[model samples]
Target chain A: MKRAASRLAALSLALLAGTPAALPARAQDAPPATRPSDDQAEVLAKVEKYLELAKSGTAAVRPQAARRLAQLGEPARARLVELAGADGAGLAELGPQVVEIAADFGDAGLRAALWRVLADADFPWRGSAARALAKAPVADEGAAFRGLGADHLWQVRFAALDALRALDLRDARAAVRALLVDQEGAVRRAAAALLVDWGEPGALRWLVEELRREDAYFRVPLGAQARFDAHKRLTELLGDDFGFRPGESPATPANAAALARLEAAARERAGDAWPSELPPIARAAGASTGDVLGLELRSCRAGEFYLRWNDADEVHVGTGNAAVVTLAPGTVERLRAGIERRVAELGDTRFWGEAGCDLEQYRCVGADGELRTWLLSKGQASEGDLRPAPLDAVAELLLLTLPDEASADPRLDRLRSRARAALSVLGGAL
Target chain B: MISLRSLLPALLLVGLGAAAPSAEDATVVQMVELNNVEYQIGDDLPDWVIALDGQRIEIAGFMRTGTLEGETWFDLTNDSCGCGTSKLQHFVRVTLESGTTSFTPDELTLTGTFAAGEQEDEDGFVESIYRLTITSL
Candidate 1:
């Protein structure tokens, strides 16, 4: 199996290596006269300023800057390309943003630049290129996605799958099917999601299997949103009861039941060929607490999602417009224990709040019907009207109920990770 | 011709006589100043921001209504549209101290107590980041 996996990886690398050096449809194919009109020097300077703001400026500045650059259109493309290719300290950070900015042009230069980045095997920004290309609405979508879908890098492959799914390319079904059993859960989930979007029976079967696995958590690094998308797709394909919650840990009975129901539904929809019995949850070594806990984290604009423990013995998690649905079981006792131990370990660690970031509040109603709430700021602030992360047990419980904030804000995610780390620290006086 | 959009804010600031107000008095806070992106991802906040807490402050932005139509509070965003509800980092929730107003596209300048922290609704949502109990608009 290891050898086979290695061989598959090698084959994927080989396929990526064999991609065409240049697409016939690219802007660079034209003569030098085809180069886009450059912006006025002052305008270019403004564009540069916005670009800088988009990178390291204030939140208010970043989005506005990005919007300005996008509105500037082709005038900003050349500079964006230059920044994307620069070897400066933070230039690489601009790759994804550049790709997004490039999409506004939807011109040949965007296509050409993306192709150049993706075709070059050693390109530092291949992942960004793939992601950008996926959304670029290129003329030759099939060849681009086909070449990239077999990329050695999991990110590139995932992007390719995303592109295929978005484009609804029927021919790429075989390639997408191959990724169903990928080594990475994200890749597999992406592949399954693509299939589900395409309404393929194979996707139904694959998702059911994922629901049955021991490590059923559909966590993909920086991909809680994608996982949520797949869960929604699955629920749509199966019955309403089969809807999977995005942030809910897949270890819950409600999730298991949902998966089981989904599997049965898939069998009915796709025929009896699909597997019937998914792997059952193994009992923990010690006596487990059947206590269920619900946690939620919401920010004003950039973050709004919750994981509520419903009376139906299910975790109801919501991301975007999707209705609250069951996910795998959450580790309520373990999480509470982790919070308690960490709070005890670090006596009186100060918690601070920020001006722009949203307040993260965690609420857990105990089995005894005692409701407690903990309000946490995204980060530690020294002087502001601040609420500390688990400033007390109530606060800690709120931090524990962190649903993946898919607000597309890295700051919120980092705050969630920080809260989890602070709560998970076993011991050591600070 | 020069695009007036970029220069408009500077011109407005000049008109408003942008000056540092005393801590006991009112301070002017721009969305850019409040939502500076330079801060690191974790919980540690910059000290300069801590100084702004509990201060009477003034800010300018576009006004937006809350999730529910009849809700008394509205939001102020850097963008004129004030469209998206997520990313609280880019907006300030504004509650009028006196009368209520409908949503408007034009930028509105308001004065209020700049309250900052995590405030959750009964339904478990972060209601605001920078909230202003508006004394004037």
Candidate 2:
């Protein structure tokens, strides 16, 4: 029994480090006396190769390396745990990978290490650690997991809920129930789904209402994606799709019929337990609604920038780091006219040159409420002679709207320089 | 002797006349159709997805990046941010036949030849179940 416990611990540790810990399950099912001896030299060589790959391989290669390393059992687990416990640079270099791999084991030491990592507010891999804890839940840590449910980051809160679900403690139900009111739509959906999974009545109403979401971020269909996720969850919990197609508009006759059938099914299942008239689905924070024009620039290395202007002449800028600033007015009309003229000048040529790391996307809502999109390669103007004047002008205007505090950001400066260089090449003024 | 350079102008004119592929020539595949399924290692791909193998296809997705430097190959995923647990089925491995490209956080529309099924690497790891080969960007 002690040996089995140790093996479980090792498995949890491996999982925490993001390594495949299934090898330990095989070991646990069989007696140690009948275990086969792996060739020492072969094991050592394989460990070295996988460790190197896990450390520096391409994104696609790293997960595979972690799996292969975990298959080596004790040697790989020991090495990962040691690396995870390292101080300073050594820990920083391999902390995420080690924590992911160590999650598979139920070893007290591994659990303690993960707990420490989870508690560290400054740790970059706290989310990973939180997820690892979920995979190998300890009854004693229910309070800790519950505490994480209230974390500021929705990702952490979601991870905490997952851990509580895995732990299956009776008291954690209220904690999970409270998150249904979470500000983030994703988290609210997750909380509702979890409650439904625990056989709580009336939670199904939340997902049903979510199907009508039409919220967007310019051209990105965030609400549709959310609706799809909700439908997927509903289908899984109910074991029926009810002929619902997420791609179709919710108001379509076919979709309305399908949703009616789903609602009937839910009502039948819930019997007298279903709640009457659930609260309306809330739009995600900062989602665009009735915006006249939106422009976004995504830099491969630098990050993402979003600018949205409404008919109210309100210009909102999102730095993609959760930082949003409202700029002073009076520039919206000039910017809109400039963009419209430029768009007219560059007709039907949406794409230019080859694909690059940076992308510029423009979205505008027409009088008929139709959304039109123009996607362009941000590096194309500099790479080739095909000058996209609209993209350059928009970039310049977006930079110009930055408040005094955001002007010092290096990313904005790089964008400003690029926009100026392109305008200078075109002999155009902003 | 006829020089190939002499034929370039006519070729360019012909290319300009038919620069973009017609809609009917390529099937538009969405990432949700591919990703919204439960799949495990060694599980056979669904028949509907298998039907897309070797077909000319257009897909829009975000490029999953490990580094900012250019690469000849990259993974295309439905999720812009790596928030959820990624599996082999969650992404399609895309290889360029010509020049390399770097990571782009914005959505990209790519036209390519699609291949489906498990492809294992030299070390016996399943690299990806879906693959795409494009002649250009």
Candidate 3:
């Protein structure tokens, strides 16, 4: 995933020349062009400053500025939109420039300007504003949505369909739903998508009908001409040195091996490690509460723990894959040791009997107090549900998991060994 | 018996697949956004929503509101494999004998039920389907 994300970043940078990693698509593809660093920034500053003079800027200036800003992508667009969002005397100065910018940059600006225009009802600007928003990468979704809910113009209402179709805000489901009855076919199409994204009950009924009706993606096998066309297009995506041998398919074994090696090297980073050491995915677990470590895996299953906050009152909390422990001042240190010891013990154990379960999907759980020692089963076990294993037995289990001098992820077992010892001390303290 | 025109598009309804919907006699065909999966009939078909829940949905107004024009076949399964999950599809083509047989130009309620879906690759919002159901009304 890390490699994939970096590759994506590299591809985007390639599309947008001049940055930290701006290697042209091909050396030959590099154009004889050079641009100053702040060239884009200067135009943007002026656009903000030239709001009153939006129409007055040199024909080339604002258009270039808007185009450059679009290239700055979402981060820049987000900043501009946010500035517009903050209302004040600055709006009048900002408004017209925004209008012109959206119009000037074509589809890109149109998408950016959609949200701001949705906030205003001023006519000529509003209509163009809406159209700009729909140019391609959609915008103005939330505003048009809020308006269409009570809008008078069916044209505007119809445009609402387009607005919804273009708008991709995750939280705007409410606004989208309000336009469900829009009087235009375009509007209905927008509604279908919104309903589907948000999983509205009605959207399904409608989609099922549409699905049965539409077959747009893939059809029958292509004819000879189509196949040739596909081949031509596919070649465009092929890299240089694609055909290792004269006229040989670029997808041959030797080339494939080289490409695989390059890809592997490119994607060397691993994902962030999961936090298995952290107990109770929640916060605040204490010895006083019979709160066992609680972890909830995925969204489906849940677990609970009954831990005592201190030496007195019993605290019970159930969590799976996560927990919160609120131990007394010294409790943390002691339990950390206990947990480490237990991990070492568990690791050393030969066979883990899950009764009837996949051990991979299970984990070791334990809790103890001064009076009673509780060993939890891999699945869900409660206060009285523990079966005590000898401390040596537990140590044996830990040894099994612990790595020798040359293993990977060895730290996990090592950490467990140390944590279990502290846990035992804490249990004895209580 | 429903023709492939309407019945076939029913198969494409899983996830967000196409913008140009099938069905020659589209009682309603307008673009809309699937914001929230407001309500679903059965299982994990989170893409659909119900208008009765008062969730606002964006839609292009369709001139024709469908009623049980006649018995039209409907598919019950949302799985990509085409397995039927409910008895619902059997009745879709079977002239939906319901009160929602017709629609007004005004954004009408997609009362049957709906499911929201993923977004499209192009410039449109996500696709949603409103399975208009007909009760004794």
Give interface RMSD, per candidate.
16.0, 8.0, 26.8
- Please give the RMSD of candidate 3 to the true structure: 27.5
Chain A of candidate 1 compared with the true chain A, TM-score = 0.48
Candidate 3 error regions (>4 Å): A1-66, A72-122, A127-144, A152-178, A208-430, B1-137
**Model 3 per-residue lDDT tens digits across residues A1-430:** 4333333333333444535345645533544342213554454443343443333332223333344455555333444444443332233334333543453334333344455555554322343344444444334346645465455333455455555556655565766665543322234335545565554433422221211111110111111112222222223322222222211222457645543443232223111321222112211111123322211111001111112222222212221111122334554334434654655554434222121100111122344422212222221111221223544343333333322333222122233343343333222110
Candidate 1 CAPRI level: incorrect
Candidate 2 docking category?
Answer: incorrect
Candidate achieving the largest DockQ: 2
Worst 10 residues of 1 chain A by lDDT: A279-288
What lDDT tens digits, residue by residue, belong to model 1 across residues A29-144? 54544332233444555566667765544333444456677887644665564444433223345633445455566656456666766666534446656776776555467777
Candidate 1 wrongly placed segments (more than 4 Å): A1-45, A58-64, A81-94, A212-229, A239-257, A273-430, B1-137
Q: How many steric overlaps are in each model, in order?
A: 23, 30, 207
Order of the predicted models by TM-score, top scorer first: 2, 1, 3
lDDT of 1 at B22: 41
Tell me, by lDDT, which candidate is best. 2
Per-residue alpha-carbon lDDT of model 2 for B1-137, expressed as tens digits?
A: 87886544334423322122337667667676577656877788766566667767788777653324467888888744442345777788899999897555456788898899989888777778899999867
TM-score to true structure, per model: 0.41, 0.67, 0.21
